[model samples]
Target: MSATAEQPPFRPRTVLLIVGVAVIAFAGFLLLIAFAPPFQGGHDARGHALSTSGNGYAGLVELTDAIGSHSLIVRDTDLLGSSALLIVTPEYDSDGAQLARLLAARAGHPTLIVLPKWLTRPMPDNREWSLKVNTIWPEGAIAALDKIAPKLAVDQTPFRKTVIPPQPAAIPRLARAAIGGQREQQRLVGMGFTPMLLDRDGRVVMGKLIGRPVYVLADPDLLNNQGLADPWTARQGWQVIDDLSTTNEIAFDLTMNGFAKQADKSPLRLIFQPPFLPVTLCIVLAALLAGLHGAVRFGAPIAAGRAIAMGKRTLVDNAAMLFRAARREHRVGAAYAALTRDLTAQATHAPARLSGEALDHYLDRAGRNAGDPPYATLAWRAEAAEDRDQLLGAARALYRWRRNRTR
Candidate 1:
C-alpha cells in the first residue's frame, strides 16, 4: 500500500476533456468581448449605423464603403475634431448640453445632423427587431436643436404619416416635380439656410447652416434603412451623399445614440479603446502565459535540503565564519605559513629534522636549485600580517610558493 502507482491520479481522457472545455469557453468569451454588434461588424437592431434594422443607416454606410469611401463608427468623443464628414443621429431625450459640446468640438468639420423621428420599442421576443409605436411629436423631435438653432421650427406636411420615407417622400410620387417647381411642402420652412436637397415639394429635406459646413437633415426617411430599402430612395440617398460630402471618410457617431462605454466619465473603458487596447491585450496575454506555466509541472520537484549540510566544505565554512566573528583570522597567518613550509619540505624529500628558520633556509636553497621561487619572503610577510586582508594576501602567496616549489 506504501508503493508508488504506475497510473497518475487523474485519467488522461478526463483531463483532456476538462482542458478542452475550458479552452473553448475562454476563446468564446474573448471573441464575444472583442467583436460585438456595436463595432459595425455584427448585428445591432437599433436606429444607428451599427444597427441593421429598418430605421438604421447601416445600408447607407455599406453604400459609402462600396463606393471606395471610408466608413467609420467613432466611439470616442475625443474623435470629434476629425475633418471628415460626420453624420450624427441624436435620440430624442439625449442630453442637449452634450450635443452642443459635440458640435462645438467639431473644429469646423462638415457635419450632417439627422434628427430622430420614430418612437419605437424593442421586441421582447427578438432583441434585434423593434415595433414602431408611432411618430414622435414634431415639437419633441426638434426641441434638442433649440440650443444651436433657436428659430428652428418643426412641422409635418398635412399629408405626412402617409410618410416614412422623408418626402417629404410623397411629393416626388404625387406632384412629379410639376410645373410650379418643388417647394409645395418643404419639411423645414426655416429661413436663412441653404437647401442641399429638396423633395418635389421644394422643401429643404437637407439644409446647411449659413456660411458654415454643418448641414441639418430634418427628414431621415431619405437616409434610414427603411428609406434606402427601396431602390429609388436608395439611389436618391446616395446622390445626396455624393454631393454633400467634402472628404473620403464618412463617420457615423454613436456616442449621442447612447452606445459609448466611456460615457459618464468612466475610465474603466479607456483600456478597451485605442492606444490602450494594445496594452490591455498584452496584459491579458501575460496573464494567460502565467496561468499556463502554473498548470503544468516543468521538471521533477526539488527535494528539500537538510537544515545543517554534512560535508568538509560546510565544516570549513562554519569554522571560517566563527573565526570571523571572534576576530581571530588575523592571528592564524603565521600558523598557516608553518604548515605550508612543512608540507612543501615533505613533498621535496627534505629532512624531517628541519624546523623554524633552518627549514625556511633549506627550502629556499632547494627551490633556487630547482629554478623555483623562494618561499622565505612569503613566510616573513605571513608572520608579520596585522589584519584579515594582509593575512589573506600573505596566505595566498605562501600557497603559491609551496605549490610551485613542490611541482
Candidate 2:
C-alpha cells in the first residue's frame, strides 16, 4: 500500500492575532498613567485647625482667623456680644475653608464667608467687614509683614528666619506667613483701615491709634501656636480684641489688597478652559477599543514557515545579464573584458595562472603555438564606428573569436 502524504497546516491568522494583542496592551498601560489625576498632599488653613490637634493657627490660620473674625463682626451686628460674624476667604476653593466657614457660622457668633482669591475681580465697593485671605500659605507676605508691626518683628537679619520652605498640601505655608504684621499693615492701608508700619529693627514707623475702636493684628502668628502660648502675644491679642469689641459692631477685614493684586486671572473666562475631561475620555475610549479589537482578532496561533520568497537568478546569472545588457548598449569593450575575466577565473582553478608570457608559453607547451595576432585588431570598432553596420561587424568578430577559443 502507498504511504499517505502529510500536509502542513496554515496559520496566518493566528500570528496576526498575537502581534495585535501585544500592541493594544502596551497602549493601554501608557494611557492609564497619562490620564490619572495627581494625588494631593497636606491640608489647607481651614482644615488644619480642625483635622489636627495643636495650636491650629500656628501659621496662616491665625491670620485668616483674625481677618475673618474682624470682617464678620463688622458685617453683622455690633461686637458688643460674643456672637459676631466671621468671614474667611480662601486663596482658592477648598474643603478646609468650607468646613471652617460652616463651623464659624453655626457657632452663633459670625457667619464665615469663604471666598477664593480669584473672586477679587468683582469685589463689592462696601464690603466693610469682609476678610479675604489666601488658602495657600503666602511666604512673601510674611517677609513683608516683618516690616509693618513693631510687636510682631523678629530678628530676620540673618535672613534664615525669613525663608519658609514649602509645606505639605494640607499645610498653608505662604498665606499663613502673610498674616504677619507687615502684610496686615499693607492690607489695612489698602482697605482704608488704620495700619501701623514698623521697621525690621522692631521700631514703629507709622500709624499710632492706641485708643481707636478698631484694633488690627497684622501678624496672626503672634496669636497662633507658640505665639498663642506666649504671655506678651496673648495679652496683646486680648487687648486688641477688647478694644475693638467696645463698638456695637466690630469688623474683621481678612481681605488684603495685596492678595487682590496677585490674584490669578479666572481661567473660566479665558479663551480656552483646559479640556481635561474630554481629552481623558477620548484617550480611554481609544485604549478600550484597541484592547477589545486585539483580544477578539488575535486569539489564534501562528504557523511556522518561511515568509520570504526565493529568487531564480544567482550571482553568476546577474553578472551574465549585466554583460549582455552592456553589449546591447554598444559597450563592447566592457562586455568583452567581463567575458575574459570570467573565462580566466574558470581556467585558473589549477594553481597556475594564464597571463602574459605564461599564457603564450602555456599555448606553446600545449603544442598549439600560433603567430600573435595584432592587439589593435581586437579593438572594439563600435566606439569609433558611427553606423550600425560597422557595429555589427565588430560584434561578429568578437563572437567568432569567442567561438574559436572554445573549440
Best by lDDT: 1
Query: Per-residue CA lDDT of candidate 1, range 186-299, in tens?
Result: 266556566666655455566777866878877777788877776666677677677677888899998888676456334554567687989988997897788678877899
lDDT comparing candidate 2 with the true structure? 0.37
lDDT of each: 0.73, 0.37
Q: Itemize residue pairs with steric clashes in candidate 1.
A: 166-169, 182-200, 182-201, 182-202, 183-201, 183-202, 184-201, 186-203
Once superposed on the true structure, which residue ranges of model 1 sit more than 4 Å away at CA? 1-44, 159-186, 264-407
Q: Write the per-residue lDDT of candidate 2 for residues 1-407, one digit (tens) a residue.
A: 33444433546577667767986897666544443222211222222222111223323334435554332312222221344433232233333433333343334443322222111221255322122343223333223232223233222212334322332343211222332232432221222222343333322222322332222333334444434555555555444444334333333322221112112224321212255556656876898788668657665678676564346656556766785666553545545533543453344342355665455444333323334232234443545554546756665654554344444
